[model samples]
Target: MYRSRPGATIKAIATDLGVNPETLRNWIRAAGAGHGRGRTEGAPAVPGSSVEADLAAARKRIRDLEEERDILRKAARYFATETGW
Candidate 1:
């Protein structure tokens, strides 16, 4: 699930899955280590880590939020005008 959603933080995923954040982190670490892709504690991110993907996901999320905000603003304005307030 983590690899599938680049925008999701570990905390968010852990909360959704009803698991502790550290437990989730450890699970991820173990999974990576099993695949020979894990990094040592305090080591830099591995090459497989998708920082670009995460950034793009974040930008997409921002855009979606902005669009929703704009729609709500327009709706509010329409309602206010209708009410003459």
Candidate 2:
């Protein structure tokens, strides 16, 4: 396939396939094989990325912060009740 070839520009491939470059690009994206212009230029994404791990950690931290804030709010309310404020 033309996709596996090195230095295969969309324009060149489109011309060879007798289709517009945009059409070929759209077909590539629709097929779920597209990675923009990066991979073709040699910036490949590694397998088993850490992005998901980082995102999960961030979400967990946000949940922890929310819980801490709620506990502090309850404590403040309890102290106010004890002091009749």
Candidate 3:
């Protein structure tokens, strides 16, 4: 409905769409359509090869950190009780 009108306020769009104005705002934000505006200009740029590799490495590092954190927590608990603290 908002698309059809093109110049309607968020409240008006929400009323026509039978949804809350905030919900419409969230939709706009997530779609990267900009506030009270239409779809963004130009096609999204694809990540470069190096960018993809970096992301993979970051994810692996995150997983390793989580495993280390769990091990440290378990060791702490074990030592805490063992030392009668």
Question: For residues 1-85, could you state the per-residue lDDT of candidate 1 as single tens digits?
Answer: 7756768888999999999998988888855643343445665445445777888899999999999999999999999999999
Whole-model lDDT per candidate: 0.79, 0.76, 0.77
* Alpha carbon deviation, residue 57, candidate 3 (Å): 0.1
Candidate ranking under lDDT, highest first, comes to: 1, 3, 2
Off by more than 4 A, model 1: 1-45
lDDT of 2: 0.76
Candidate 3 residue lDDT tens string, 44-72: 42436668899999999999999999999
- Pick by lDDT: which candidate is best? 1
Q: Which residue pairs overlap in candidate 1's backbone?
A: none
Those runs of model 2 whose alpha carbons end farther than 4 Å from true positions after fitting are 1-48
The best candidate by TM-score is 2
C-alpha RMSD (angstroms) for model 2: 7.9
Off by over 4 Å in 3: 1-47
